[model samples]
Target: MAKSQTKTKTTKPPVAEKAADAATTAIRLKQDLRMIPLDQLDFSPLNVRKVAASAADDAELLASIRENGIKQNLVVHALSGGKFAVDAGGRRLKALKQLASDGVIPHDYPVSCLVEDEQNATVTSATENLQRSAMHPADQFEAFAQMIAEGRKEDDIALKFGVSVDLVRRRLKLARIAPELIEQFRVGELTLECVMAFTLTDDHDRQMTVWNAVKDSYHIHPQSIKRQLTETAHSASSSIGRFVGIEAYEAAGGILLRDLFDDNAAAHMENPELLERLAVEKLQNAAKVFEVDWKWVEVHLSVDYGAFRSFGRVYPQDIEPDADLLAEENALMAREEELAAANDGADWTDAEADEYYSIEPRLREIEALQKARQPYAAADQAIAGCVVTIGHDGALRVEKGLVRPEDIPVAAEQTEYPADGDTEIAVTRPNVSPPTSSAPVPISDPATTLRKADGISASLADDLRASRQHILRAHLAADYDVAFDAMLYALCEQALSRSYGTEALNISISPFLAQNRETLHPDTVAQKMLDALEQDLAVEWMTLEKPDDFLAMSALPLPQKQSLFAWAVGLAIKPQLLSDNHPTPIIEEIGARLDVDVAACWR
Candidate 1:
């Protein structure tokens, strides 16, 4: 076996310098290196390192020792018998023992040692363990790369090091990362985690792009970097991919890139537009099944609750299943109920638990299939349509009974008037009589009366605003200049007068304007508008945690502040008929001036 040589610098010291150094350190002791038989050595209690006992690693170490002999000498102290206790290189001693046990060497194998006396034996052991140099990560990566380049399989390398194949693959990936990024990692500018994230994509251009984008910011977390790189790409686990299976997508010429080392690794689809087109085509084809029962069938890629808000819904009834399905459903329900009964404080077997969990998904599938087989009512089919969309789980989602605004029924109203030549006559019912007020209701402060003129309930406020919204629109349409001035005046009054003194909480519009908004039932138009405004503003205001934040948000520029104030005022307008059932001339004039069709706004 060959011995490993340590490199040395051969420059000799001057004779005077060497003598002075020897004199300065004359009190320090040095040990002489020599060879001794294994049986003459004992294990030290004060050894700092515990040798690994794993079979694979132990075997590897033994192999290395048998192939190249011990490259380093053990530090030992003299004991009573011609024996010495080894205080350092415990792993090496174990490896040599393993080799001897395998009969590769004699039981009393000759081993090399650096002999130190008892006084400094512990210090020498500690110093050897502490001063041992570790291989640099860059060098390790390069070594792995060299091994791979030499045609060594990843599994073979992992076996050689007693590590996971995944670790070897990871090291290889780290080796292939952009040289600049690797340099950053080596120089301590980027963290190991950040560098590992860059290895997710082998595209050097993309890695550099993301690094340049966020390199200045402190938010260089691994997840953040991954998100930036993959935001434009859809994951194979996404809804679209699930709806359109990976096999089908690939059949349609879609490409998926996978990470070699990520756990629960996600596949990235390169062409999003192609995926979406495929998804929509699938949805459209699915919608054809409902063509017979629907007046019109539409396909949408994504559907939310808000998408159905503008339409009315009608439900399908009497969706009866066939004999086999009926029997199957009943049996499933019975089994589920029995399982549920047993689950109440009952210790169930593993088989029973698995069976219980399996019942729900199968039952849901049956129900959905049965529902698709059902027929819609003739009236509903005549008035409503059907929609096919993709669910979050990438399954077909069918929304039936959607009626457009034009399809909704409106009740007819009739009015009677006197004939032109007939004389005016008053007819009173026999039991009805007009009664005069006993006395005038006493009024307190006129300002208080004015404030209370419009009902103060939340519902009343909503209806009044809806009724007046159209009128406010007409007013603004009549003169933009006047509307702007009105907004400024209102802002000034509220910002100055309202702040300086206690004024009435008169946030609502005039009572006369709100009067025409009254309806048999409370109107939701104003509430919906307010809800939308709040939702839009919530993104800006919801994050505010203090009064100062709110104040800062409120302190908008003059134009923006005026625009918001004007919008609030506009909500008070009503689109009802003017006095004497006359058409609003100002609306007509504005419509003409702006070339706008008034009917669209009314609709």
Candidate 2:
């Protein structure tokens, strides 16, 4: 007994912890959940991210707690008076508090807690999640993201939690997702990629549409959702408008300002030219307006494009054309009878109206001078209250303004969201497209044989005269190490050649490439192509009007697989190309033909 006492003494709680334990125990409640008073319970300690009163979760927790007696103690700190800080298990605590309030549980139930500091609230919260893997990745991310927003560096957060920056980024992205979808992910109904794609648009309506579609139609793939959304969102005209950066103008509560605020349009807004056309049409109703054959009048009058409409200061009405312009234009209007006869009384098409309208001979030089004067100034003035924005959000943002990036007001960090995973994802902000050396790969040993090909145009290998020229240049091989491009062309040509029993195949390339500006970055080229294709596929897929975009992939054949490798190799060989950036992908075809140790090459 004496030995046991000494051992107990040796194993006693440390002084610091002993005092903490005593304080914590002092506040402990022995009440059953159904008997405690409301005033005795404090819920601040529990960090409940959501208000899901899942009977299942409740039933499971109650069963576990009754059976296990709260093995994982809740974390809380003391508040002024007798309240406590809640850091976790908020829902369970709520249930207990509710029971106590209803007199089902006692006022003081056995509980656990730790005093958390203001400076360490985030740390405490994040640490709680880290220690317990029960938290969803989204919840953990929100906690970590809170820390970062609270002035913690990403690297510091990473070190504290022993996680990588990428892991942190993914979690942070998950947190940005809508609470509804996030709840789904938390409940194991949705995937992270789905959330990533769904949050592309801020429209909860659109999100729900995609969500229910996924739930009902068995369409879980991100691409299919994106395709469906694109089909719903854009048409040929709207798609083309997107290229000019203003598709949202037609969306609900939308307007395109730059075009609306054009110099001529802005001036004409107050004195809307279409109103004159209307008056003219009214006169035509009374007169024989249909006698005119002027096609110009027919088009312009029909499409009353409201290119100019704005909010803010109204310009004063001016009845007088500048005195000089009025005096000069006196000569322009011919006899009404002769002019009316020329028009044949038809409505003016814009082109026809423009062709028929003649300025006074004396004012031609002055008009030319006015055209040459300050151009960008009007646009700058027009955009003062407006901003160019992406998506059909009511966000009016200004771009390419006189204010430098640094000179803009100290703006709060903007909340940016990516396109919905199901929506045809439109990447509004351009990414610094990296070199398209190959599919994402790492640098492998370059000393190994790297056979280069030209482009994807290559076909089955045939002896090309181009190979001799390259051999003569590189001087490495005249025979075995053939030009991949030449071989690809030969392969393709061979396929075509054999099919038709002719050596020639008519494969025409685009003229656009010929006109492509010299000195363009390869990354830029690849990015442009990728952006176009992504947009097209997204539009086509979303519209539900087009087939799956398997064109680029389907174009390839077994005979052409070698050509794909050769094309990538050519990119890899470029002196400027960081071959390390793009290691070759695991080519199963190549592996089937030759025992390819892709792991070694990738490594």
Candidate 3:
């Protein structure tokens, strides 16, 4: 058996011998190099690059060929009528043709080509295109930066490269990223988007700081990078920035950092303090319109509902309409009725529906005009003030007829008047205690305040107060009946006498503003449930004026009213811990009644 095996091995050939022989033959094939006329060289149908070159690519190739005369020879094969067909370098052929057409090169210009046999033309073309690799994006970025450093103007570079000015600028911006980050991007440790985000600022130190902070985190996304980079800056889309428009901000010498790569991305303002100052100044200027009629005008960059909790609001009253306005209203109502009757049980044309719908808007306009004519009471305006602030939508929000606590009139205890000629009639008012359900009991002793205890520090006292506030809020959130009654009493007292004041609840009929909702409770089950309930409620009442708001609230079902009241009361519940680190008896009593499990609520 061993002798037979040795005998067979003597005649065996190596593996892949056929492939090696074919490769050796291919390498030994003769390639014909010749200088052919540009017009004589035609593109081959067998070329592997079938996609048409873009105008920019063509222009770039033409400029390069015109400047350096073809550095690489194109592969070609002999064709009919003494012409050569280019099997590869289709882009170069196109550029040569363009140069000839533009008279930069003659039609008979000598173009160097490597002539191949027809049988190997397609293979050669495929090998030429498939084997060549495109330049890496990092290399291109650095090349552009090098060109800029060599005293090349950006515009000139763009023109020479056949690219857009914006694109050139973007490359330049990307090149400005920190070298360490660029290396990371080159090595695939960082994404191009992350590097682009770093281009938002030119400060390498800042970029490195952001990169180092995010390098160890799983959330090193482009958006997160941009967010960190512009942490102290304000977005141009923010309410304050919008209030102070980009044009105005720029005119005031504020720098705006824009993402050149993303046209839709929001620009950031480098000077947030300047933006705030501009917003406040504009608000102050806007307040001038209200200052003419109001007793005092206060300008705030944004609305802080907490500051206005103690301020009483005066609603607009309806006035009698003039004869002309009444006639217009009657006509509009008649038209609306006629249109409705015509469209009953049938689809009306769009034009007819539009005409019918226009009647209501006119009626609303008339109603608004009438309401505008109704003046605020002179007595109320004397003691009340107006606030000019930025709304959530970045529009000027003017809240008028806000009476301050100090400006409210107090009731006298007794009254003495002359009733019959020289007879003085003394009428003494009865002393009545405020209702305990709505009125908060005054804390007079220092022991009842939220001050430091025997062993606890001030910070601990604050933390304990905050904890108690959260517990009270949780209890109030569940007890809808108590919340409804409390809100009702507060609203009624403010509306009727306008002299009621309490520390129990800070009930302000304004939208809750939480710049960071997760800062307090990060996605707790209770928060989610409240959010779901709010989403289910009908909130059209928020958009209506005073009388309309009243009508809308009255129209709501009992359940919706209770839900709204609960949500409002939950938000209105503040920390009742006084300075002495002592819990308010009212909050403690409410918590006791509800049987609030502190551990469960915290959980």
Candidate 3 error regions (>4 Å): 1-31, 50-71, 95-110, 305-309, 319-374, 406-603
Rank by lDDT (best first)? 3, 1, 2
lDDT against the true structure, per candidate, is 0.66, 0.42, 0.70
Tell me the tens digit of each residue's lDDT in model 3 across 250-280: 9999999888877766688899789988987
Candidate 1: Cα lDDT at 579:
61
Model 2 ranges with Cα > 4 A deviation: 1-136, 148-173, 228-232, 235-239, 246-603
Q: What would the per-residue lDDT of candidate 2 be over residues 231-342, giving only the tens digit for each residue?
A: 3332222212322223323332333221111122111011123332332344344233322311111111121111111112112122434556545545454433345576
What's each prediction's TM-score?
0.54, 0.23, 0.58
Ten residues in sequence with the least summed lDDT for candidate 1? 428-437
Which candidate should be chosen as best, given TM-score against the real structure? 3
